[model samples]
Target: MSILLIDSYDSFTYNLRHLVENATGAHVLTIHNDSYDLPREKESLNKLVGSVDAIVIGPGPGNPDSAQDVGIIPYLFETFPKTPILGICLGFQCLCLAHGCTLGYLEHPVHGQISRITPIDRNSLFRDFDTDFDSVRYHSIYISTVTDDIIPLAYSEDQCLMAAKHAQNLHFGVQYHPESVCSEMGSKLVSNFWALVEKRETVPIRDSHLLQTEPLIKHFKTTLEYDYKYEKIPKVDILSACERFPDPLLLNSALSPGEWSIIGLPEPGRSLVVGNSREAGLTVGTWKGETKAHSDSLWSYICNHMSQRYYEPTIGDPELAKCPFVGGFIGFLSYEESIPLTVNKITSGPTPSTRLCFVERFIVSNDKHTFVVSIRPRDKEWIQQTKSQLQTCSEPRFLSSVKAKVEKPDKKSYEKSFYDCQKYLHAGDSYELCLTRQTKVHVPKTVAPWELYKCMVKNNPSPYSCYLDFGDARLLSTSPERFLSWNNQLSQMRPIKGTVKKHPQLTYARACELLKIPKEIGENLMIVDLIRHDLYQMLKEVEVTKLMSVEEYQTVYQLVSVIEGRLQDSIYTGIDLLRHSLPPGSMTGAPKKRSVEILCHLEDRIPRGLYSGVCGYWSVNNHADWSVIIRSLFNYEDDLCSTGTTRCFRCGAGGAITVLSTCEGEWDELNLKLDSVLGIFS
Candidate 1:
């Protein structure tokens, strides 16, 4: 069977064709009114209509009043009264006029306005309609009144007839456009219409014309209420879920309960033949920590390590060869005081009262490297499990290994030191000083080859980002820096450039202080300026909704700002704007191209994989949220086996360095950043 689609614009036809074809799996023949004359179009359409099973009039910009003299609607009804016909937007008005309904133009046609459907009667066309779902209206002229023979299937809140069906004829029309993505029940509406048409082709005419009266209003009302009340629900018991999972890395914790999970497998690639039962407990919550600097430090350390050991002239010049794989560095932040709560409860071993330190886990070259530098947990189970996992992996390296030879510090002394640090923090003697570090892993032989291809292809395609949180812990890491994410809107970018570190004792504090410096602040401000400029190009009015501010995250503190603007009516696809303004100012530094040159000249690698790229999703309403792909990894299939290593990860880190920046200090700061991930190994 085939369908006839009449549209004034090509875009409407392009979008609706997919929906119609997908629903009915039937051939679609489209006719553009503006391009074809009525006489020629009529001759062609007449022959096509007879062969097609049904006709669908698509939505488009144009006045139905202007097209009334064309007589296309009358021709269709007269030629194919027995065949089912559906009208959308302008076509709906024309259909109503053809069926003796009146149409008039409003002074202001509510374009892009959402109109709620209030069904007036039971009918197949309004099967999914009640009082809940809203259809997007994009027209100036609407059906003002209908005749007695026409059934008022749906109406807008303002009492305008949005949809109607003829009582004696197989004709239906909707004032609102359902072809656009903005139409809430568009897909369902099209599906129902096609189902009705299919039934008519098989059953008796009377049997196929039966109307449905069971109201779906209650279900829709409950759904809307639940969506509205979702935020008010209390958080679930995360600790119990974690205990059930046993792996701290895979616990589920987020704002919405039962929505997300953290899955932990052997880093890079670990072949575990376990089924869903074993994998179910291995998922956890998101991680809340800021470790960009630490990640940078780790990358620097890796470069240095490669320079000393893996560097080879034969594999192409070290300076020119792009890094083959992407890398990921994660800093899991926890409240400083919370460590003791989990540490003291260990059942099998003596609990240490040592100052809690950050952990670092690195995935380089596919293999995982975990480091535990400063704060050692007293829990034997936690420590033992971590050690066992590390040892199982080949060529594991350990730093700061206490030989169990030095006499253990007494609990009194350790507790006193802990309180001393806490006292100093509370008294404002010092800002909350958290330890940080980075770890470097050689992308194991298992998952290394797919790196180069991914880097080349994803240069700057779409703004991409992801957030997975399931109650116990949450991971809010995206390479692209998403400074502010709320209400289906997002502002993020890749921020790079660094300065040398000063005052060895005040690294963390100095890093925080430098972020506030006017020079750095101005650079960030310039990036915001560029973003605002880009936003204003697509939106009506732009606003710097958030000013530059220091946000203290788990492992590191960052300077974040926000900008917002009202989207323009003319702007259809946001991906175009995202593609045009990419490799964000934060990553490129001020005077973007110059910064890239400097980076290429200074850094030892190229194509930072998912490190500097962006990834995220866009909703059906054109509302979008995305993030920079910084602390992330790309997992690829291993060449050796079909089901071999399929996971690879990459993380990128750098800072704006002025003339005052020293190489050694930069190296130390980089290492400090890498500490958090490396600590995870220990």
Candidate 2:
């Protein structure tokens, strides 16, 4: 069935659509009216009456008392007496005005407000309205006085006419919104309204809905609250809890939890889209029923659509920054997504492209009290179950200890590829080419993915590190590079190029000597320029905030640089900025486009997946922070043939190669990047 929904300039109209469609199981078509004005033509009103089964006049920005404003509501009231109509907030005021009542401005206007209402009398509209019905109120005007024909259904603390219904007709109006999450029985109230048209029994409708990911989301939220939501437990305790979870799909961040540590996932009613598809995060960009397909080709329109549906509503609010996934999405960009932009399509891996909705189960976080955290906890049952699942690796039949034999190309083959890239540099086909290869780990079957993640975090702690799960394919990332970070009008990128092998024995004087090499400094300068070029497309007033600075990690001392820029007013979306700077310049080399093409041909097509890609959060306010998906282990567990210790794992590692790059030294650079990650192999 079709419902004609007239939008009165409420930025939150479609959010109601998500609730209405889920509650009524009907399609809702919307038309935005200007200043509360609907189509006045006789033919237009006739067409609307002929087409729709019911009408929903939505909430809006202005007072309904204006003679010029809300003209259509009164017009429709007289013209279509038999049609079913429900009004909320502004529309409710219009209903009062049409029925000979005046609207009064509240002494204190409530914006983004939520309040409770009690049903004083029973009406056909509030079938399920129980004691103390929770309602969300966000309007400044109230139905001041109603004629004897208008009957009151509910009242608030201040004695406002919170709801009204026609004495002789089916017309119903609610002073408070039942569509918002803050309104406890909002979905139920909406469901009853729909049942009025269907003439069916009203069923229980949940205010929130979580798609296919509900199981993982449920386990994560429940376990997270049960374990570390309040207390600041040791990091290991959280890890033990996450490892007990039943599902293979999970996400973990090595961040310290404080206030945001207790956030639970939003329910399905909060989402416009829902899915439970299980595909790897690395190679999959969009899975069936899970998310939309926005290939590089469709990205422009996708961002445009998102800006309107997700961003426009957040323009001037003081709390504009806290809304999650306003028009945001979170997932991985496989190394292969940009292959078409770089070299020809090299179908390197069997994984498909997948990206998930940040619309449902959403979270909004900033750097302070509300930090974006990735916590992984097992099922509450814990230890005994964890023991049975210990051996997740594909090692030999006999159980063995720590030392893991690297199973990929030999040292000679890596040096050979290094020289192959050098030939391209000499030919002037590339500037700097980032070259990389994956080294597989083979060991005893007893290696738990959770234990390996804990070890990786303990040894190499990074600000943006995470354990991203995609069911069978999981990524344990400890990346140090910030490909891009957008916070409101500001944009940033931190690229690490120059590397110095760090060891306990190496003195500061000796390490300084190694780090001061001209070659390393040149590499850092080169990529910064490439990054500057990439950022210039979407940003203005671009500048380097930090020159080559040394960030000391546990095992490596690397030269890092930060580029900052003001987002261009014309650039409303940053996904294009992401596409523009993809496969990150530090990983692809200088003169990015040409360098990436050269690497694809020179290094042999190794499936990059999450490696060299990125993972982070995206907020509706056009804000984001992403880390280069590097120094990560990709574990591909075979479900059918899988027994204990039968999983295939690879740690992808690489570094920048310039014309001055030495073939012998490149492998060592790659090895140092893999240094901390190798503990997972142990």
lDDT of 2 by residue, 1-682 (tens): 7776766544345556656777877756666544222454556556655566777887765457654445466666667767778888777887778889977666654433446687877657777566776665656677788898889998887788888887776778888767653467777777788787854232322211111111101110111121111111122233433443442222344453211211223223232321121122222123222444333333443344345533323223333234333334554565665655333222223453333344322222333322222112342233233333332322222223355566755788788888887665544344467888877775445666655666676677665666655444567777766788776567889998787777678876776677666567657766775676566444435678887787776567778888887765533345656766777878887445556666777666555656777776555455676778887776655422234655556778878776567777887788878776885454
Question: What shift in Å separates residue 618 of candidate 2 from its native position after superposition?
Answer: 1.0
Q: What does candidate 1's lDDT look like per residue over 1-682, in tens digits?
A: 6777775442234446656776677666666544344676666555556666788876644456566323365567657877888888766777777778787665444543457877676458767565557766555566777888778888788878888887877788888766544457777777778777753232112211111122111110111110100001122232222222222332121222112222222221221111001112111112332111122222233223222321111222232122121111121211111111111121122111111111122111111122211111243444345444443443212222211111111334323433443333232122111111112233433422222222221321112223322112123232325522212133333232233333436466666677766444543454554455444333434456555665443345556666665434433234334543455545544234333433442332223323443443322122334455443333212211122222222234444332223334444555544332222221
> What are the candidates' C-alpha RMSDs?
24.9, 23.4
Task: Please list the residue runs of candidate 2 whose C-alpha ends up more than 4 Å from where it truly belongs after superposition.
Answer: 1-305, 308-328, 341-350, 357-405, 442-448, 505-510, 637-645
* Top of the candidates by TM-score: 2
TM-score, each model?
A: 0.33, 0.53
Worst 10 residues of 1 by lDDT: 222-231
lDDT value for candidate 1?
Answer: 0.41
Residue 553 lDDT, candidate 2, scale 0-100: 64
User: How many clashing residue pairs appear in each of the predictions shown?
Assistant: 85, 33
